[model samples]
Target: MAIISLEYYSEVLGMNREVKVIYPEQNKVENFTGKEIPVLYLLHGMSGNENSWINRSGIDRLIRKTNLAIVMPSTDLGFYINTTYGMNYFDAIALELPKVIHNFFPNLSTKREKNFIAGLSMGGYGAFRLALGTNTFSYAASLSGVLTFNGMEEHFDDNPAYWGGLFGTMENFKGSENEILPLAARFEGERPKLYAWCGKQDLLYSGNEYVANELKKMNYDLTYETADGIHEWYYWTRKIETVFEWLPINYIKEERAF
Candidate 1:
């Protein structure tokens, strides 16, 4: 596999942003096909930049066997939302970034089925919000994601005014544009197949459970799992592997041995 870190000017964000991309390389023993490749738009959380997954996890080595293309983008503390403060992060990820990616990597498929999104913490919320609001992705997964109650003061202790800047105010958070629960419910067309996993002891566990139960009630296609873990890389690393298993990856057996 080839890992590339690059930067480009984003029209939506009106700034240069960095992204890390992983593309599969050809196996010495087999011919490489020119067919479109499955793409995963992986997102990073709060303080994490584009390199979070590559630096903190074994993501580079995990999918070496498969012909999947991974795109990791940085949104800083924007929570992947177009903040009330005028940051156009939502448009950047949900709409423009895909076009940027497609232009940069023609081998990546633009089809709904071949495109997926996943993230951890803040990114987890972003993944679900983007998929549900735009109805663009075929599937989305969240690892210890913050799916509801964006106004929770405990999570944003460092910046008490955080949610206010993102959603206008704590009172407006529920059923607002930045909230995922209302977005998921309002989606009229086909919804993305969702997968969510969180450690039972994690602070956000109850919220994840609430989301799972609601999704089940809505008859949405959701896969929810729980285990003994906390909000850390140890838990996230294991969940990522689980995500790959759930995704429809066309693995190249011969290339895996390398």
Candidate 2:
């Protein structure tokens, strides 16, 4: 596998951004014919950047034998939303990022069936938001995501500037496009298959359950799971492989030298 740190200017974000891409080595694939490869748009949590997943999840080692490309983008603390402070991170990820990726690597497939999204914590929310808000990804997964903000006031109440810049205020978040439940409800196109996993002891467990139940009521194809874990990288690193396994793609296995 080839791990590339690509830095480029994002016209959407109006600034230079860096993305980490994990691409399958073409020379390693048996009978290689330069076919289009499936892609997983992996996102990071609130306190992470593009390098979070690759550095912490052991994803590079786990998927070394699979013919899949992973794109990891940094969105700061925007929570993958079109922030009230005028940053269009949601558009950057949902729309511009793919075009950027495809422009750079033409072999990465653009079809919905070949595209997937997943993340941990804040990024888990981003995965659902991007998938439900747009028809780009065929599958979406979340690991201990903050699916709802119904009771998260205490977490941000003291930091008004931080919270205000992201959403204006907690009151403004409800029923807004930033909230996942409303996005799922208002979405009118094909629904992406959804997978959500949160630890039984996680602080966000109730929020995940609430959102999962609501999505079930809305007739969404969602898979929700819970086990002994927490909101840490150890839990995410183990579950990310499961997310890949849950995706509807056949892995092209290649023999490794090591």
lDDT against the true structure, each candidate? 0.86, 0.88
Candidate 1 weakest ten by summed lDDT: 249-258
Residue-pair clashes per prediction, in order, are 0, 0
Q: Name the weakest run of 10 consecutive residues (lDDT summed) in model 2.
A: 249-258
Q: Which model scores highest in TM-score?
A: 2
lDDT per residue as tens, model 2, 60-179: 888876778999998999999899888999999999999999999999999999999999999999999999889999999999998998888875688989888988877888798888
Candidate 1 Cα errors over 4 Å, as ranges = 28-32, 150-160, 251-258
Taking the tens digit of each residue's C-alpha lDDT, what string does model 1 give over 1-258? 899886899999899998899988777213557478889999998889899999998788877768788999988989888888899898998899889988888888999999999999999998898888786899999999999873365544556577568776566666876777777778888779999999999989999999899998988899999999999988897788889889887544332222
lDDT of 2 at 11: 89
In angstroms, give how far residue 176 of model 1 lies from its true place: 1.3
lDDT of 1: 0.86
